[model samples]
Every structure is written in C-alpha cells, then in structure tokens.
Target: MACRVLEYLILPLVGAKTLIVGAKSVNYMKKNASTALRVRWSGSIRGGYSSNHGSRFYFTFDRAPCTGPAGIEAVDWTGASRNYHQHIEFEGLCNNIPAGHMQIGFNVGTLPGISWQPYLGWTTSGKPKITAEEVDLGENKGMCPHHTVFNVKQHTLATADTDSGIYGASAFRYTKLAPDTSLRVRWFGALGAKSQSPAPGCLRFYFTFNGEECKSPTPIDGAIAWLTDPIIQTRTTHSSQGDYAVALNVGQCLFGNLNQMDPDPHVNDVSRIIVEEVRLGKSQFAEQAVLLTCSFESSSICGFTQSTNDDFNWTRRSGGTSSSYTGPSSAYSGSYYMYIETSSPRVLGDTAVLYTPNLNLAGGCGRLVFRYHAYGSSLGYLRVKLYNGQHMTQQLWAYSGYSKNTWQETNVYFKQGGNFQIAFEGVRGRGVTGDIAIDAVAVFNVSSSYCNSPNRDLPKAAQQVFNLRHWNWYNLNFTGLGEIKSMIYPKISSTSGLRVSMTATVMTSQRLGPCTQWQFRFGGHVCPVPTHSVEGSRYTYSYQTTTQHLFPITVSGICTGLPAENLVLSIHTSSCGGSPAVDAVTGWQTSFFVSAEEVVLP
Candidate 1:
C-alpha cells in the first residue's frame, strides 16, 4: 500500500486558479484586478512508499509575471525574491526491509524571460547509499522554461531485516527575473544528503542554465567509516551574445561497515551530500593577433647584410647559372638563392663572407636556421661564426668537402646576450669547380636553450672551469725588482676556486752568471721554489747581448666565498754577480702573460 497526500492554498478573491497536473500541482493568482492579469504559481509533491518505487511531479503556468507576497519576499528560497510565475518542490520517504528504495522529483515547463534561479535541499539517513540529485530535461525555449528536477532516494536489499532501514527527503524551487539587454545568467541552489554503510556510497547534484552546462558536478566518495565535509558550490556566467550555459554537480560515497552483524553490512554506513550555494554569471572571450612573421620568398633578405673580400662575395643567382651546379634552381623556398663561386681559374685563398644584421638575444636562447647547397668535385669549406665584438668570436658551425647535390638545412644555437651578428665564410678550394649557396636564414629568440649543451670533449673534472675571468699580457723592461699585480678579476657570486698561470722571460743585456736569481709570487705565496738561478749568457755584437730565461708557473687555490676582487702577482729579482734585466720587447723579445680562470667545484 502507498500513502499519498495533496495540499493546496488558493486565493480566489485575487482571480487565482488552483489545478493539479499529473503528480505535481500549481496554484496561480493575479497581482491585481486592474493591470493585465499576472499569475503567481507554486508547485509541490509528497509521497510515502515501501520497496522499489519512484515518482516524478510536474507543474506549468501561462507566461505571466506577478509580484511575490510582500512579507514573504525576503524569506524566499532565492533570498531576494522578485516577480515570478512558477515554482516547484518535492519530498519522499521509504520504509521497507533491507532491500527497499524510493525516489521523488518535481518538473515544470519552460517560461518566458531569462532571469531565473533554482534552490535545492536534501537529507538522508544511514550509510552505503548511492544517489543522484538532478538531471537535464531539455533545451530552454521562450515558451515555458525547461524543467530540471531534484530527487533523493536510498538503496535497498531483497531480504527483510528489523535492523535494516532507509529514508531520504529533498526540496527545491526556482523563479525568473526581468530579461537583461545582454546575455547573462544568475542561478543559486542548496542540496544535501547523507548515508551510512560498509560499501562505498555516492551522491551527485546537477544544474543547468541558458541552455549550456556550466561545470561538472562535484563528487564525494565515502570510506569504510568516515564523514565528509559539507559541500557548497556557486557559479556565475555572463556572455555578450547570450551564448553561455551554467551547471553544477555534487556527489558522495559511503563505505559499508565491517563490524555490522546484519546481512546488509551497509546499514551502519553514514554519509551526506549538500549543495549550500550555487551561482552563475556571464562572460565573453577576447580577441588576439600575431605580432610578426618573415619569409625570404619575396627576395627580401629580412635585414641580412652581405660583404665580400678580394672581389669574392655572395651573389644572388638563379637556377641554371652553370653546368657544374646541380642543386635547386631557385632559393630553398623563394625564386632566388645566394651563392658564392670562384672564376674558372680560381685562386686557392679566395674567400667570401655573408653576415646577418645585429640581432637581440638577451631574451634567452636563439636559433639561426638556413639551407645550404655544396656540391661538385672541389667543394669549398663553409663556416658559421658568432661575432660579439671585433675580437670576440665563437664558431657555431663548419662544413667542408662534397655533399649531396640537394639542399641541406642547418640550425645553429647561441646563448650570448646583447646584439650580435652571424657570419658565414666560404673559402676557395684547389679547383674552381667549388660552388656554395645558402637560403632561408631565420633568427629568433627562444624561451629554452636551443644550442646550449655540455662540452663532451672536456673531461668531466674540468667542466667546472668558468670563462677567462681576468688576464694581463705585460711587455715592460724591468731593470730590478718589480711587483706585477694583474688587473682586478671579478669573481662571480658562485665562484668557489681560482686558477692562475704566469709566464715571464728574463733577457740579460750583458753577460749572465748563476748568481742572478728571480722569484715569482702569486697572492703573497711563492709559486715555485723561492728563487730560480740563471746560469747561461749569449753575446750579440750588433744588439745588446741577450740571454733569455723563461719562468712559467701554474697554481690554483680556493676562493673561500670571497667577493669579487683583484689578484696581484709580485716579481722579485736579485743579481749576486751582474745586473740581469727583464726584457720588454713589443714582439716576441720579452713578454709576460698572466691569466686567471674561475672554477666552481662539483
């Protein structure tokens, strides 16, 4: 037997009508007698059952707007009640043996206007139960707003047990506001549930607005014996063209109780699913555009500079220019290709160079890509070098000898900062048959290192050495003792060690004997043995009698976490028999090279 109850509240004096449509019923009333009759409607459903049973309720009303009850506005489900024409609410209870279930829900037809909000509430007893709160009915049309229902129920078993029992209840309502000039949506709702069982239990809540699903439902899973935190979610979506949708989901899981003696171990499990808040708004996506793009197909070198040496230069040549050239007739992609070639009787040392305009690489790593063609019996060598300044250069790529007659693409990576140029040099070989060509050069900054890699040739133990930190090549005549402090070497913050190498040549103008001694000290410490004695002599009649003695020493020490500072080298000289002078000749006559390198220990 089933127990069902129906209740109605009507105000006939206000031109109101009450009707029951299917399992759901609605009561409608006009705001006033003078103005166009605006009907106010509310829907509800109640039922009690045992075993497997479920039911759905629906309510509908004409497209009419009426102000809600003055005193009841603030207490309405949506908090701030407005003029609405339709609302729906439902509740249900289940009583049976271990295997029993019940479900109830309310649905309504579509209504006019875009302003609408839905509220939800749910409660349950015991654990180890699975439940889904809401589902999408259909699309939203102007007629009656699509109907979305909220429902809650408990699972049951086949056998009856006095200790096994389950019950659930839920309610919800919705209202629409005045339509906005732009596309937008605002929705709010509250739903809750609970279960207790040894097996896992789950619950889910769904919401939809403006014909689109907002976000997926939030799910809660239950443990063997655990309680979940209250779940409250809110969402808002806005669009300039009313082309958006909003939705929410809530779920919970309740694990079965192992200690329970009852056949239905889940009878002792407990859980809850609640949606305390839900909101939806509107939004639009912004537009975007590319900043720049370059392709050398139009004969535009893209700001690359070309230079030649000894009348040998890279010139743009079309296909079929010569018989020995069997590569692409045009550029790698465009209709023109830049190539360097020697005359029939080529000069062995003739050279040609191509340079790219200064490029900014401070952003990070950068890539230089180009296609080259090198064929024929006597192929000249081609090399790519990076030039930071007039004297600082790094070779990036090099190639020589014959290759496939087809174009081969090459990519070069560099990490140096600031403006720098890339140059390609082609050297003439023994025969005039050598011909080289390049095309499609591109240089661009990259977020990641394209060329930075460990030096495989350097032993692992030596890879920690930093670049040449400080160095000084001195060429000055020293007649007596002299202290030489090399230039100040700035140690980077990460420097852990320093390596120093010094070489000095002593040239005596007159006769030299073993009595002359020279001492070299680094950082206040003697580099080698304290004094090195010179014992030989060279007599030159035309020039000053010159006898040279070479002193070379290499040493390293820990920096001890010191700040960047200068390193000084002191040279002491003494003559026991005759004066020995430190020669300072511009060329190779006399020279002192002192260099220091910073090292980071592993």
Candidate 2:
C-alpha cells in the first residue's frame, strides 16, 4: 500500500500564531484552545491495479491549488507541506506466486512552490524470508523552478505496430510575462536505419496555450521536413544516430501550457528537450503579409515601367507570338503576358529591362514569386535583379536554355532594409527565333521557408508509382441494341488518410464513346470528371472499340488520416440519336482496370 500528499493549503496567520475570525480568534499550542483555524484541501487520492500487468498496483495524484477559506489576514506564506501514510495486506497479493524474492519501486514529485524532504520508512509484520530495502531520510532541498528541462530517451514505433506514434503529453508552469513573447522550443531526434521509401519518417510538434492548440507558423505544417509519407512496411532491429531539428510555438502564456509530439510512425527515437529559449524582444522573422500583386492581364502594366536606358521595350501580347516556334502557344493562366520580340530593329545580344515601382522593404525580408515561359530552340536568358538605394544592385535569380518548353515558376528571397525596386532583364539569343516572357509577379513580407515551399494551391499531378499500392479490375458487360444500363461499384479499402489518386483503363468491344457518362465519389467529395465538360453532374465522353482509353482521376479529402469511405464509381450509357448499338446479335464485353498512387498529405 502507498499514500501521497495530493494537495496543500497556505496558513495565513494574523499574529504570531493566531488566526482571527469575525468575532472569534484561535491561538495554537494552547492547552484547552478549541480548533478554529482550518486549511482547505481538495483533489483525488486513489489506487488501482494495472489492467495489463497483474503484479503491479499504482496510485495517481494531481496537484491542486492552496487557498484560505475566509476571515484571515494576508500572510507572507512562501510554501506549504503535507504528509500521509498507508498500510498494505501483502498476504493476499502473493497467494499464487512461488516462493521467491520481489522488488518494489516508487516515483515522487514536488509541487511548484513547495520543497519536500521525504523520509520513507516501512515496517513488516514478521521478518521472514522476504526482505525490503532500507529507506533514507535526507535533508530538505529546494526544488527546480517551473521551467524544468526534461532529459529523456523515448522511442516510437511504425504504424505497422500501432495507428499513430504519439509519445505522450506533459505540461509546465510558466513565469508570467508580457504578451506576444515568443517561447521557442528546440528538439533533436533520429530515424531508423531501414527507412527506404520515398517518404521518410520525422517528428511532429504541437502545443496548447490560452485554451487552444497552436503550431509553428514558419514550417507551414508542424511536421518536421515534410513527414508527409506514412506508409512503412518493413523494419530493422537497430537504429543509427542522426540529428533532426524541430520547433514549436507557444503564442502567449498565462500560467502554464501543455505540449506533446505526434511523431510519424517510422520515427525511431527522440533524444531530449535540448533547448527551450524564450525571446522577450521583437523578432526579425515575424508573421507574413502580401505586399504587391500583379497578373499582367490588363491594359496597364501594374505600376511597371520600361527602362529608357535599355535597348528595347517589352510588348504585351495575347496568345502566341507572330514568329513561329519561338514563344509560348498561350498565356500561362490568363490572356496576356509581357514579352519581347526579336524580329525588328532588335539584333542579337539586345537587352530589354522592365522596372517595378519603388517599394519600401525596411521592415524585413520579402519573397518575390513569378512565372516565366522560355520555349523555342534559341531561348534567351532571363535575369531577376534587386535594385536598392542609389547604387546597390544584386542579381537574385537567373535562368537560361530551353526548359521543357513549358511555363515554370520560381521565387527569390531578398532583404534590402531600405527603399528598393525589382528589375526583369532579358537578353536576346543567337537569332530572332527567341522569345522570353514573364507573368504573375507578386511580392510578400514573409520568411525564406515560404519561398522554398512548393505552390500548395496548384493540383498535384496524378502518379502511378508509390508505396502501398492498391488496384483491382472491374467489368461492365452489355447485350442487345439500344440498351440503356447503369452500374454502381464501390471500390475502396482502408488507406489510412494518405493522399490518393486513381487512374483507370477501359477496354471495349464496340465504340460507345459519345454515349457513356461516368463519375467517382469519395464520401461526400466528388472527383472531377475527365471529360471536356465540367459543368454537368456526370460528364459524357467518346471511345474507340478494340482500343484502350486512359482516364486520370484525382480524389480529394482523403488526407489528414481520414479513411476513404463509401468510394463509388458510377457509369451509364444513353442512346445516341440514330446511332448503332453495340453488337445487338451477340453480347459485347467491356473490361475496366483501376490503379492508384498514395502519399502523405502536405
């Protein structure tokens, strides 16, 4: 049996030893004095046997606040102490055990304001073959402050063993300070050796403050280094030592807050709470805000001007350039882009420069994002430069050569600490068969992580190769002419909330192309139809007989570890006006095969 002091109360004395009520006063250490002074105590003190381990019995206690009831003057009470005891009947617990030696251990903790000097002494009813360790009564010592650093070596297993790799939860008391004070937490961890998938395991950090769960604003997600892939199948017995950096943000603290790690399943182990630094001053990398935006789709250049000192001016045109095999077939997003033609008075090595309006970046670092199109065999070079003050000029980004003949996007990070502007300089290539264009320019006051991250708003490409692959084959058979039939097939399995994309192939004996309609649904979210018309409930498309048709389908809302539920793909065929049906005399057959790609949600 065991007992612990679960709560305490402060004793605020008026005089040397007197606690005065409204009309009565009590003095302690008196012969016949009535007990009138009281100290309030609360919270639970209970014991129970372990559910899984029959040999273990434990007790839990929570720290409660200390306060006086009423009718007492305020006293300079720095701390309080409590004590209790328990008696155990050991014969009943050892009835089924063989005659052998047993060991017992206990853990203890002190309250935030109080220091405890514990003296644990025990006595046995009869000193038989069993023995116990002698308890030591030591001197009282000061306890550590509220912000105690933890030094632990905890391990986490992959999802193959459990659903999630959550280590545990804990809280700490905080010294009250000003609002918006940054509480920075740093951690170092390592992954297992056998992690050989496209998505490796990493640590995740989260904290609760002011009654709300918060994550770091800089990392986009609280996941360290994009722990976006969670499918781990194989494992190794050993682990290698490596350093992994992670952080958490505790917005504003009042008294104390809770924090924990929800690490990826494949994470091997975490070392310690390495650092917990609190910065009370303003930081250089604050929150982000948009500074400027331009799409280059209007008659105006959005406060941009042509440099008179350059060789030529940039021309705003819609669609492709007049010269063939030299420019983009169409604008990247809209109807127009700023480009330069090299057919007229412009010769080889001619340069074109465009300048943005002066911007005040004295606050902090900024991110510049834009899209560029450099097609054709003789592609010129595009350089992005930063012009600051009267003479400081630095090239931020530059690209040359033909890059897949498609529109590509990039971003640059710069900090001038003063007034500045941006310049987009283009140099013509060997011949007039070169045209370079730029579009969708924008700037924002943000950290470098924003510029380094991929564009999240764009749709991810449908993939065919990944870990934990799933696929199946379905058939839709038809018979007789002018037959209108429909079928609904639920095709899904437990995906554990990973990002999934589906691709399908349909093989038919006869062409029912213009008369077929199909749709795929995951729970309440519907995947976009692959046909040309996206405005209808079900899209219609055509196909060729004896040929294979490929459909790329993207399913949304399967992220965040939510299971893909009630996934159904429906198809129907309608009678086309005056169109011949598929093999009226003999039955026609159609086979459908579907495969998927799964990855961790970003």
Candidate 3:
C-alpha cells in the first residue's frame, strides 16, 4: 500500500490518536493534556505514474495537499468516462491539497502498443481485496485533510517495438521528485496490499538521500539506483547543477486530506500504490511503494504536504474560448481538434489553437508547450504563434522551420499581463510539402513542460537505415510494408555509414531511381547530407557529420512520387528538371553520428 502521509499530529504524550471528522481532522492525541502539538495533511502521485504519455490514460488519487485524508481504498473504473471518475480521494482548497486540483505524476513504462490488442473481459468473483467504501468519505467537502495515500506510476513507450536494437529510453518513470523539494523519498511495495498490519517485507528497498555525493567510483557511491528488476534501470545522479541528482525509490510519503476522502473512485493513488511497467519488454513488473514527505510551514493552523494526482490536459484546445479538459478521450466538451491535411502536401494555413481557462493571471504567469516533429529542410516550416485570444494582445513563444515529419518539441510563455492563443502553424514547403503531428499540449500556471510530465524523458530520434550490408534487398518480395514495420529500430549508428540492410528481402539490380529523405538540421550551418543508392530493393547510404546542437529531430520524411522510370531522376538532386525559382532543386545529402558526449559544449 503506497501511502503519502497527509497529516501527522506529533504529541509528546502518546495516549490518544487523531480521528477523521467530516471536513477536518481532530488531533485527540493531546486529549486532556496541555502541550505544543502539530498535525499535517499531504498527498502525492501514486499508483499510476509521475510522467507524461499518449497511450495509457492517468487518474488522480485526488490527494496532493498539506492536509489529511479521510477515506479507504477501493474504487470503480466504470462511469469514469467523460468526467471526474467518481469521488476521488483528493484534497481541495479546504483539504490538504493546494486549492483546486493538484497532481504529482510518475512514469512506469509498459508494452509499446499492446493495449490496443484484443482482450477477453471477465468477472471473477473474489473477496473484496481491500476495504470497500463505508460511505462517501468526504462527500460534502471540497478537500479532505485526514487521508493518507501513496502514488505509484506505470509508464509506457509510444512507438511500437518492431525492430531489435537498444533504443535509448524516451521516457522516465520511477521515484520522481519536485525539483525544488529535496526532502522527499520514494518507496515501493513488493507485494500487493497484503494485510494492513504493515507487511514486513515491504521495505526491501532503500532510499539513500544525496547518494550522488560519492567522491570515489563505487557501487554504492552513485545516485539512488534500484535493485534492477523486470524494469531494467540504472541510475542517473546529476541534475542541471552537479549538487545532487534525483533517483527513483520504493519509499515516498504523502499527506491525506479531508476533501479527498471519497472512497468511491479509490483515491487515485490506491490502485497505483503498486504498479508495473515495460522498460524494454511489454511492461514493468507490478510495483508497490510507500512515499515519505516532510511538513511545510504554511499557516499556523496548517502544515504542508504533496499531491497524488495524474490529471493532465492533452485535451485538444477549442476552436474558440475554452478551458478545462476531462478524460474518456476526445478534447474538452467545448474544444475542437484541427487535423491538417498535412497527410499530403498542401498550402492551407492549418493551425491548432487553444486557450487557457480564465486563470488568475493577476497573480502569476501562464505557459504552454507541446511535442513537434519533422525537422530538416529550410522550406519546411511550422510557425507556432500564440495569439492573445484576447485579441489585440500579443502571442506567446513561437518557433519555425523545424522540419517535415520528424518529431520534436517547442515552448511558449506568457506573462500575467495578457491572455494568449497558442498555435502550431506549419508553412510546410510554404505549407504544401510535408506533415507534422502534435501531442501532449499543455499550459501550466506554475511550471512548463514539467507539469505536462513529471518523470518524463526528453525524446530522442531512433535512427536506422535500409542498407545492403545489413540485408539483401534484391528479393524485394521477401520484405514488404508489413515486414518493414517489423524493422523499426531503436537506433542505428554506422562508422562506415548506415544504410538499409534489406538483403533477405529483395535486390533490384535493374537500377530503379531511388528517392527518400530523412529529417536533419545544421545548427545554423549546413550538414554533410548522407548519400543513398538502390542496388535492388536494398537502399544504401552513408556520410560523416559535424557535432552540433541542431539534432532536435522530429520525423523521417517519407517521400513517394513520380513514375518508376522517374526513379532515375530522383537519385540526383542536381538532376534539376524544373524552372529556376519556382521548382529549383539542389542535389545534396547529409550524414550524422551521435556526438561523443551528450552535454552542452563550452
């Protein structure tokens, strides 16, 4: 049982314990004695995850507060469709959680793309695993300051795993911490909630704070790492500053709140108190952890706590004025998703727009960020313009000329002075040559992309090539589109130059003009475009690249055009056959290699 202690009433005398009342928690620990006393309520990311994703949906334990929780665990996943899934054990303004809805996300990887597969539904009857809801725990209250919850996360990869290669992780899920807060710890449960009597074996893991401070290289001198399980994971012990690095764990703490005590939805953290995910395989093993956190000095009558929420707003913004987004897929009830026909080449000013709900900008600032793809040609462009939707106002941050179909990201921020309209505008080939796909769009009042995903890993391109050396391309019949799908690579590096290894598939000695382009950038300079050729169905290409910061890659440009005979003309860009300015073309290729170091150059 992953539990984040919401409120802790420490008394010098240990006779009485506190009790959960309707909207508040009573500290009876002092009963008739008269001494100093303290109580707290907090919550945190439990059960589900502490990161961002596009596949599995997330739920909120509903308790991320400095108050206490007052509910048991056990919920209904039905009716969760379209809106808040029943009464979540969460805190509201009056509860421990910070006002409205607060969340602490997590990442726990899983099968790349298996959830879509068919599954047989079943209804096996067994005794209630945990305690059932006695009543609507925190019914009439907005927040609960008397509940305890522990968040557990399970993450998954987006792209399907069809190839066999070591693909660097594109996501992070495990013990995550709020950047500003370092006093918290993460804990996991080895077994499901066995008996509430505190399972002795539950604490097999250890959370070594400041584990990144080892002067000598030793097994125990690194950042907080874990006992590698089905979820193969090492340790990364450094953040932006070298002071200390963050690590995952099996122990973490959270506070319970009064408003978040509704047992109906099974406080979002309850189910995730233990989780499993797919690191390289289909999912990480089921996980269980207890969270430990400290109390904050808020008002005299209250202490501090964490939140256990996983409610994200991937909700496609509306065509007009829109705000909050709910679950069950589809954008919010009032918004619309604009899918550009970028499916092909077109110059239609396609844009995706959304507005933040009327936030109290009078107090703080608002920001927006989202994932992007397709970064190569200077001709391909996506100008993300944030309109002040308030009309006459200025837009937020904007980026352009990223690429064609590669995946990447961009950010925009706005001050409290004006409202804004965030837009991803693609002027591809002047808005007519390629495609761009966007996911996980968000606007945070406090943090930026961080809120969109807590334990999220910045994405990296999975490079690969179809070269003759890897396979024989002559037997094209052996490998078709279906087989190509299985050729997905996590990464492909070549000292002699990477190329499509389709030997087992086909070989077309009958020179067929081959044409295709991968997205690339030159860090304000030009890149040594790689070269490729068709020796049958197997395409081969190679080139060396200069180290640069321009690798914010998006998608591999998938190009198909003209007739079979035209293949001859497609190989050489110098084969320029069109007019001067209108159809001007250049016969150039680029080559790239992973830089020796993944660090900012001095």
User: Taking the candidates one at a time, how many backbone clashes does each contain?
Assistant: 67, 3, 157
Give the per-residue lDDT of model 3 (tens digit) for 476-568: 122111112122221111111221211010111112222112222222111223121211111111121111000001011111111011011
Worst 10 residues of 3 by lDDT: 125-134
Please give each candidate's TM-score: 0.29, 0.33, 0.22
Deviation of model 1 at 411, angstroms? 1.6
- The reply for model 3, stretches above 4 Å from the true place, is 1-339, 342-362, 375-380, 389-392, 447-602
Model 1: per-residue lDDT, tens digit, 1-602?
00111111221111122222232223333222222111111221111121121121221222221112110000111112111111121111222111112122123221122222322111110011111111111222331111111111111112112221221221222222213221111111122223334433333232344433333221111111111111112222222322222333322212222232221211121112111111111101000111112233455565666663444667677663464544445655546777777656558868887777776676656656577888777777889988885544689899998567788877555676787888888887777667788875666554342344464212212223333432324334355434534355543322234444333333323343322333334455543221111111211111213322221111122223222334454444443333343442111112244444444433
Error of 3 at 127 (Å): 26
Off by over 4 Å in 1: 1-300, 308-311, 325-327, 451-602
Error of 1 at 198 (Å): 55
lDDT per model vs. reference:
0.34, 0.35, 0.21
- In candidate 1, residue 416 scores what lDDT? 68
Error of 3 at 464 (Å): 31
Residue 98, candidate 1: alpha-carbon lDDT: 19
Scored against the true structure, residue 16 in model 1 reaches a CA lDDT of 21
Root-mean-square deviation of candidate 2: 30.1
